[model samples]
Target: MIRTFFTAVLCGLLFVSCNQQQNTTSEQSATQATEANVYGASFDAENVISVTQLQDAVAATDSVSATVTAEIVESCQSKGCWMDVRLADNSTMKVTFRDYGFFLPVEDLKGKTVVFTGTAKREVISVDDQRHYAEDAGKSAEEIAAITEPREELRFVADGVKLQ
Candidate 1:
């Protein structure tokens, strides 16, 4: 009787341990899958921009189309949901998805080429937010303070962005 009871307990413990390990592995796999699918379906920059240009196209049918491609200069710390890309003109443009949807790792986007379709509007960021952004961009205290006052600048809310 003693031998049987000991054997039963040992088998039960092993089964529970194995079950726990399986559950952990499954959870990790699910997390990775979720991450992989977070960025929405991959799209070409041109297609994304085409939809954004519809309004402008309608306004002036003969107007020449404008498209922009730039390197990601900065990204949101929380994720790649928002980023600022440096244009060929040496201007930085804020790029966020339409309706504030979806996110990506901002750090992963730095130095990447991103093509986007959107309208660029001039906006003034709050001083505090400006300081924070400057710091995040690796600016020194003196550099940050010099431009602490709100400044108007162009910002782009992209309908779609393709990173290369």
Candidate 2:
């Protein structure tokens, strides 16, 4: 009978320890960003290149695979579907998730530093698409209409993103 009671206590203790809850409240997660907050496919954030190096690499080729750290100039306000991260030369490059697989929280993420791994390429965005992005960003009618011309710009499709 003593052995049975001891075994029962041990099992209870194991259950309690195994079921320990994590502090993952939304408030904590939203406000607390670290290297642990990884979105999409996981990749090491090491050996990261600056956005300028990524730009130069793609300037001569169709695309280049790299991990880049950049500051957010703007983010998709409606759905967090895309972000315009600032480059070293003051230009912004659009970064989108690979395969539309993951999305960031819809919030004002301007000036936030983000590290991402993916393929950077140069692409010409159509006027219609540009207007769509402007609208998604909550731009005014005047701002959206001003994007009448197609833009040749640097673009990145990130497979993984680490929010910092």
Task: Highest TM-score: give the candidate number.
Answer: 2
lDDT per residue, candidate 2, 53-160, as tens digits? 887888889999999999999999998899999988898999999999988878888988999999998889999999999999999999998887898999999999
For all predictions, the C-alpha RMSD in Å is 8.1, 5.0
Candidate 1 colliding pairs: 80-104, 80-105, 80-106, 81-104
- lDDT, residue 18, candidate 2: 62
Best by lDDT: 2
For model 2, the run of ten residues with the poorest summed lDDT? 19-28
lDDT of 1 by residue, 37-136 (tens): 3354344445334323433443454323334567787787754557887754566766667677766654656787766665666567888877877676
lDDT of 1 at 23: 100
